[model samples]
Target: MKRTVLLLVLLMAAGTASAQVPSPSQPPTPPPMPTPRGEVLYSCPGGIDFASTFSNDGELATLRMPGQPDIELSRAPSGSGFAYSDSYYELRGRGREATLTAAGRSMRCHAAGRPGEPPRTYAGGTLTVTLFPDGTFRLRDRREGAAEPVLDVGQWAQEVEGGVRMVLRGIDNSRRAFRELSVDKLVADDGTELRRTEKTDPIDGKFRLAGMYRDAQDGGLFTACLVGRTYGVAPGGAEPELEKAWVEATPSREASLYVEIIGGFDNNNSITVDRFLTLKRDGACPALVFRGSALRDTEWRLVELDGTRPTFTEWRRRPLMRLDDAGRFTASTGCNTLAGDFVLDPDGLRFVPGPMTLMACPPTEAEIEKSFVEALTAVRTAQISGTTLDLIDATGKRRMRLEARGR
Candidate 1:
């Protein structure tokens, strides 16, 4: 009887404890992050934005900005967010969307998709070489209807004589058959030979080959359809120098880009191969500009200060100004460089000028630099109309004018 009574008491206690104990509280659900598929528009902190297409497989991506080349991205390190790459350019993810950071801007975007074929998706697994008679070559992944070459020689090695040598180490997925290429002889089928001169030997001298679109300068910008060349001049010869040639470029600067091919003698392999030369000439416009919006990441050149434009004499390059979406603004006076911060709001724009870099330049360039900084301090408002960007002061007068390049 006592044992029965004790068992009943224990059962009653157990029921009482159960009644007092609290059930586990469920955790709150996070807001749903956007699906990483389809067309997504990303905005940078500077109010500048761009659009791109993300593949449904959730890895491949394609940038779809007009006037810009489509950048293809493969998968990156995993997260609830995803990242994709090609090194200098990349895409990352955060809270509700991912970010594509290109040319130094981190733009956040919301992604969505459809059941259609991915615009950036391409058939991989083939390799091809694009060689010109001038001996300049490009390495590309053979794809169906690829608008751009996968790999150009400039992306890897220094343009040298006999061409540059590169090795593919451990990447198995790379375009196969990329190895040392042995060129027996350079033929004239592709214009490998430059005009022979009495004083210059094709292999050891300099030539001024003209190109299209002479470099230009607006305010502080060096604008040009400038082409960069590298020649493997006799490896150990005194460094090469630039000299005037029978080439001149203006209006359609095509004549400015003259291909000067030379034959390189390799002491290591006892092989003679052809190489090319690069040119540096004084022109106008520099291609590097601030991109995006005016109050955003757009670069500005001071084409005119107040009511007039300054004329440059020695170096036709103009003072350049590039402002990124990050509110960071940089200015060059054709000599020294200056930078500062800018703020944008519904009330308009304002500049919080910063320090200038200290460097000695020619008297003319120094004077131009001083003028550029002085003009920047007067900026209070700004606007973008078509391809023209203008800066106005607090008194509502135009302070500077710039033409947007490569927009």
Candidate 2:
């Protein structure tokens, strides 16, 4: 009975102990955990950005930020350091060492180099950061000496598309102020932007002033004018000039009755035979006077030849009649010479003559000689109307119609 009572008491005590202790098979409920503070949402080839509500320890803190400029940090002899975010910025330096923690990592950096230490510099340094449950992060720089911020933190942003627009204002060395431009657009493999097309402005304009027309048969000077000005005359002559003299044909004249002067200075000076001569069948040829620098005071007679042939034979040995592809005519007047090109048209013929050589001849002969040459070189075209030959010069300056010399 004593042993039973003892065993029961022990059992009751064990049961009470067992009731006090939790069952080993059952797991205890855990307390609620705090949310992580900081995170690295995005990064690019040049930069990265981390956001956290961390306390700023007395030491300088550096962080990589997107779209931000690079940062730099340096140490001074006063056991102090300077940090900059962009080009040349100076930051406050404290003697305390700095630590940074972000993205589940941490780094520590000292203010200055140690004794007997080789000089060391860092372009980019490893970064470590720790995030507390309270949305706070501890950032550390794991370099021997102070370092610059990975980039300018001022321009950091989470979602930057179409990018931030930056306006740079400054004066040039010449004191000329201008605005700088920055454009952001997608580019193709050829380096051309997808948005830009075709040039906006024009390239050039038209050609002007082709040439002047001169009648080959008559000494008519004609020029196509675009500027409302006459050409082929004495430069200072009448502003608005008329077309050069022209020629027409009359009945009973041969179509090749024009004269043209050749072999002169630019054909400026030449002689011409008037086409108005009437052809007479008499054995004696009609006489015409050619007065110019090349001509002497003499009369030349035209001899009627048999078989419709025209020839010149006298003191001066030369051809009396010359025929060109256009039926315009040229002949030696026994002096300065005569030549012309002519144009034959339905209405009439245009004649252009060359200028006469300024050689001084007898006054009476001078006028005739110059006039004859001027009449010839200007001939533009020739035609036959009835028995008459009409000659027109290139410029339509001069015109002549000749009747049949021999009836």
Worst 10 residues of 2 by lDDT: 288-297
Query: Which regions of candidate 1 fall more than 4 Å away from where they truly are?
Result: 1-294, 314-316
lDDT of 2: 0.25
Q: What lDDT would each prediction earn against the true structure?
A: 0.40, 0.25
Clashes of each: 37, 115
- What are the per-residue Cα lDDT tens digits for candidate 2 across 328-374? 44444434344444443333334454322233344444444444455
lDDT of 1 at 60: 85
**Whole-model lDDT, model 1:** 0.40
Candidate 2 accuracy as TM-score: 0.17
lDDT of 1 by residue, 1-407 (tens): 32233234233323301122222432122233344566554323222233556787877877533112346888778555467886656777642234555445444332221112221111223433333221122334545688643442311111111221221211122322222222222212232322212231112222122222211121101111111222222332321221222134222322233223333324331112233344434432222111222233333456787778877764335776665546676666775556677765435566776655555666766666766666678766666543366777778888788754221
The TM-score, computed over Cα atoms with residue i paired to residue i, of candidate 1 is: 0.30
Q: Estimate each model's TM-score.
A: 0.30, 0.17
